[model samples]
Target: MSGNSAERAGELEVVLVKAGRTKIRYRSELLLDDGNHVAVRAPWAGEGVRDFGFVRFEPGDVFTEHYWRDRWYAVKEVRAGDGTLKGWYCDVTRPAVRDGAELVVEDLDLDLWRSADGTEVLRLDEDEFAESGLAERDPEGATAAVAALDELEKQARAEGGLTALLA
Candidate 1:
């Protein structure tokens, strides 16, 4: 179904899981479909001391995740329970798949994070991604993943940045 229809119907449920554990799940009221990318926002599920690269969540967090069908990267904006913006977390992953009730991403173990104001960029988990054997198995994909992180960082510093892209 098109994103507009999914948004109007309020039936788009996205579940994000990694390594057999669910990281987050939410029902989205608006889904943006821009040919190759889809974006959705909702309050994060559960409560924990969740850590992005440059920030941490106490108990509650709301997030907007933007997924690209062709790119191996997804950008997520983290916010506090009170709706205070925190930062951006970008995940290098396999292209997302959208099923009837879910959207799945196979995270590639590499991530990028920047503070709320586009300062302090961190590239995280490089060792993990290397140890995961993804590079040996798919060298081209690994290269693309790194390139995606670079491009994401560039976007984070752009005039409109991710917020405009999501909007």
Candidate 2:
């Protein structure tokens, strides 16, 4: 999974190991690949990023990422690793790609966080995404990406919305 080789795209599992620890803690499935970037869907562990401190992994903190090539943003469902619902985290970025046997996402830095109950929604890293000049490069796609986030947030707040998709 580490060579400069490309495979005939199909179903694949991307193992996410803890930064320092060697054991695999998560697996994201790549659902599709169209010679460009592969689409991955999976539950990701959530650790606070803004505070700039050590991130402690909780027992049941997970976010389900729904990634696709047609959309510029990937919508995710935040939940406990044990399946307790939390909220949503959206990342605005270029479509994912399959690097060797692994799926790679170059996160564009902009993100949106919404509480599980739909009460709090925060758009993160606006400055960074803007600084990257993605909007200037492709204004329409950038705007549509943000719109996709809005739509995903609304759907995530509904009962059985995100989890069903994950299933």
Candidate 3:
């Protein structure tokens, strides 16, 4: 689903992975294109750390570049404990300028997957995910999370097209 700016802002669910010595902890704060509010911070770090949530890499762990924005942003690829290559953790770049930043809504989507049966969606809903566990690579969550995503889409559209959130 697209849009969902303010909702995304309120719906922000961060999964903090405390990396071991070799593993690097990457704390990603995905915002819904909030004007001048889209920022990425360091793990346990307060105040002006670069928006790109880059952490020290641990041995045997791989962080690859995925989606790129302009000549700067590059989405980080995170590999979970299950050997699954998950999507970006934090991607930082100059957001697309819509109406000179007013009425601009950048889609902030945190995608999770569901099982082939689809019943799994309900088990790992948003709140559960917020407390239970993290979303695997390309894998859908329980019904509730999926429902929230659906609602988020509707809400996103109602806000002001896609650019409104960014604005």
Candidate 4:
């Protein structure tokens, strides 16, 4: 699978480790080799920038257990940076609402897409998010952040950090 990844075109192969049933995290290496296959160039390069004919991850995203692997993502026409291509990260999660500084919210349901030039554009469900007044958080990041914060607070209290602060 990594062999064909555009992110692995001129560099190390993209390797994905399983995080859970829903998603697998992969580290994609990018190296610009114009004469070869993946033609990733710097963003500064103007019109000559490589053109991405198809965006695989953005549209037909499918999760599967392939080659006896746990779970994998199949993105077609995937391009990486330096090849003047952008990458996308897509997911759906809980929503965030803000009340005060106590709640530092972020977007949660952020489906990300990258152009060949490395511009990350988000894929969002407008109607769903708008209904929640998610001005402070996206469904993905905000939800994850809050959950992590909760854990942090718990650990801090366990370590007596909160009590120390009061002193």
Output the number of the lDDT-best candidate: 1
lDDT of 4 by residue, 67-155 (tens): 10111111122333323233332222322221111111123332323233333333334455445544464455445534533432343
Q: Which residue runs of candidate 1 sit more than 4 Å off their true CA positions? A: 1-9, 15-30, 51-53, 158-160, 164-167
Which parts of model 2 are misplaced by more than 4 Å? 1-60, 137-141, 150-167
Could you estimate the TM-score for every candidate? 0.79, 0.56, 0.21, 0.23
Residue lDDT tens for model 2, 72-121: 55666655667766666677655654446665444656677766666666
Q: After superposition, how far is residue 13 of candidate 1 from its true place, in Å?
A: 3.6
Backbone-clash count (model 2): 5
Residue 96 in candidate 1 has what lDDT? 85
Comparison by lDDT, 3 against 4, better one: 3
Better of 2 and 4 by lDDT: 2
What's the CA error at residue 127 for candidate 3, in Å? 21
Error of model 2, residue 9, in angstroms: 15
User: Which prediction has more favorable TM-score, 2 or 3?
Assistant: 2
- Local distance difference test values of all predictions, in order: 0.76, 0.55, 0.32, 0.29
Better of 1 and 4 by lDDT: 1
> What TM-score does prediction 2 earn?
0.56
**Superposing all C-alpha atoms, what RMSD in Å does each candidate have to the true structure?**
3.7, 6.9, 15.8, 17.4
